[model samples]
Target: MSYFHKLIEIGKENAFVYEYMAVMDSENRKYYLERALELSRNTKIRPKDYKRCSYIAFQSFAWREYDIALEYANFAYDAKPTNDIINLLGCIYHHNEDYDKALSLFHEVNANYEGLNPYVLCNISSCYKKKNSNKMAIRYLEKALDVDKNNKLVYYSIGLIHAATGNKKLAIENFEKSLEIDNNYEEARNALNSIKE
Candidate 1:
């Protein structure tokens, strides 16, 4: 038996062990995830164990179990609420289509966290775009550019916003920039083609 399997059988109450194993045993993710949750409930899990919960939450997010993801994220928040964890919670909210909650949490991260994380800025831009506030979205994306100009996705997002707003020249320019950075960027290429056609 693998060490992870042994841990599952014997240390079934150790959230930390299961969390570690979950990552290690990627091929059997759902199995380990189930064992991890099972183990988590069986012990007096420490506050530090919340990191384990957060790991599980992230895995759940990757698996697209949004509700479980949020639930585990909240569990982690209850243990130790940091900017990173709160940012994760914000992303979960965004995926759930609770834009208001997502934006609020993102703003919370922005205010509380020391430095600007450009991904968070891009998320803010996404929220604004979802609200059809293209100008506001553009503002945030531009801010993201000031922070990290090399993010191809940022350029692609700007291209999309420009396209939506009928700024064809700017849209094409941003699209070309995005494709320049990533030759295999199919979405940017498709967008550029559609615009040209």
Candidate 2:
């Protein structure tokens, strides 16, 4: 790939080329962005490279391009395979709606990499919820709460699941708690409103 090589040669001189890429503009931008990140990686080693790729993956995720997010996340994981990268890959898998794959990645992070962090547990809860294993989902969500009581997101998610399971009182309580923590939480507010009937 001469384009990548050219980028490698140009280095920081052209580093700014990847600042922004509109979603509809070009599919080829993925390669260029990956390469630029790789060029940054070459400075140190796989760790730096993986971080750069992960940053790109996050940007793609924010753009709702799960494919692109997965592509870059895979690169980062292959580069270092750390617990952080594994969990990030798990997040990409989650957003792509491959709950099983997301769960597996999260499990790897939990069992093989980091201890069960609040965020990892929250993601596990999500995967389980997607699979309709409400018991397991609630279990993990509760565990996440134990790990981080201040996480408004955890409360919001638990509210959603509880509402779905017809635990109206518990759902309302969780939604209220979520809103109490972060008053601007639109999803929780909406859920609270819908359930108030």
Can you give the TM-score per candidate against the true fold? 0.79, 0.74
Q: Model 1 — TM-score against the truth?
A: 0.79
Root-mean-square deviation per candidate: 3.1, 5.3
Return the number of clashes found in candidate 1: 0
Clashing pairs in 2: none
Q: Which residue runs of candidate 2 sit more than 4 Å off their true CA positions?
A: 1-48, 112-116
- Per-residue lDDT of 1-197 in model 2, one digit per residue for the tens? 44534654776334334523322335766665654555444543456667667777777787676776777777777778878778878988888789999999898887773444878888899999999999999898888888789888899889999899999999999999999999998998999999998
Task: Compose the digit string of candidate 1's lDDT tens values, residues 50-134.
Answer: 8778878888898876876787787788888878779889999888888889988988887774336778888888888988899
| Candidate 1, superposed: residue stretches over 4 Å from native | 1-45, 113-115
- Candidate maximizing lDDT: 1
Provide backbone clash counts, one per model.
0, 0
lDDT of 2: 0.77
